[model samples]
Target: MNHQKSSVEQQYVLFKLDNEFYGIDILQVETIEKVMDITRVPHALPYVQGVINLRGEVVPVINLRKRFNLPEVALDEESRIMIISIEDMIVGLLVDSSSEVIQLEDADVDEAPELGEQKDNEYIKGIGKNEDRIIILLDLKKILGITDTNEL
Candidate 1:
């Protein structure tokens, strides 16, 4: 199998959070599911909503809004859970909604800007520009603080 991409445009799974658009590498995404019951975990991080029984496999779920310190809103009809794989881990992200996959060219993506703390912005992979839209591409490992420091 050829691992090389057929096109220069990279594809991403787009989701909405707090009305802003965010994208994750499509290759890392397993599936997108509707909002389901989550079992709360004791002493888990504030952003972790809980785990869900996904096909007998318990997958931890995180609230993206909470993870980003955005205002919380009650999950409604449009709510969804994005199941993604990062390295050896599989986790779900509770998003406001997700319904599309987008393609972005290298020239259309800009490096994540240096926010207040450059080190704190590693989770943002880049900013994808498509016409009037701007999608925030994310690095799941950095967002979940799962980067292996041992490799450093």
Candidate 2:
């Protein structure tokens, strides 16, 4: 089998958060939209910015900047929400901007290296570096509290 074709089949939708580019499995993505009015949920986690009404469906939006503990970047014309599903939860991740989907071979993906003492490390699955940029693959299950990591 051709390596590139296999990678393309895996499919990923890439987006920018802070200064980094990250890729989430396209299978998990439901839709993408421009920044919408989000209603704040009292007592929610800081990263959990709030919720938005999507054609009658209430979806929680997460500020990737806050989730990663990075400096907040004010939303502007380029901001977007990438709606993704993890197990049973539908999450909207706010990204600085959306990038094009690039096909990369399995060989291009590698297990994420330990960053040491950073809480954000728990969310990263592996690092995929291409010719010009690195795509930080996310472990959505672990990141969204779907899987228990206390044992690890």
Candidate 3:
């Protein structure tokens, strides 16, 4: 095990959603792209915005706001699509805006609090404290709805 406590610094790709800052493991991020034309996929989950031709691959995109049940808003110039691959499943996450990448040591992270019995809150991995900022660290596995490990 190469894991160390506070000695290890983990990088997170931060983004804004409904004015709140959120982050995901930097390793899972493939690229950050500007908003592009998306083709809607019928019978898909509500959160799913549909697919895009990323290079030659058709990657599915999801709106973070919809996924979190936040009020929807129009995309602006600062809007971005973060391409992330978790457990061999590659997808694009649409965000209000793209933020800079940040590093946080383990000591800077606190476990996420229990937010009632809502299963949606389970996607939060921890709370990262950076200076005066609070970044909600997200668990991509749960966000991607990957409940079956053996099936993968």
lDDT preference between candidates 1 and 3, better one: 3
Instruction: Give me the runs in candidate 1 sitting further than 4 Å from their true place.
Output: 1-7, 149-152
List, residue by residue over 98-124, the lDDT tens digit for candidate 3. 789999998999999887886957999
- Write the residue-wise lDDT of candidate 2 on 15-99 in tens digits: 9887789998888998999999999999999899999998899999989888778898789989999999877788899889997
Cα-lDDT of candidate 1: 0.92
Superposed by TM-score, candidate 3 places the C-alpha of residue 62 at a distance from the truth, in angstroms, of 0.6
> Which candidate tops lDDT?
3
Ranking by TM-score: 3, 1, 2
lDDT of candidate 2 at residue 67, scale 0 to 100: 79
> What TM-score number comes out for model 2?
0.87
- Cα distance off (Å), candidate 3, residue 51: 0.4
TM-score per candidate: 0.91, 0.87, 0.93
Residue 121 lDDT in model 3? 78
Error of 2 at 118 (Å): 6.9
Candidate 3 residue 37 Cα shift, in angstroms, is 0.5
RMSD of 2: 3.3
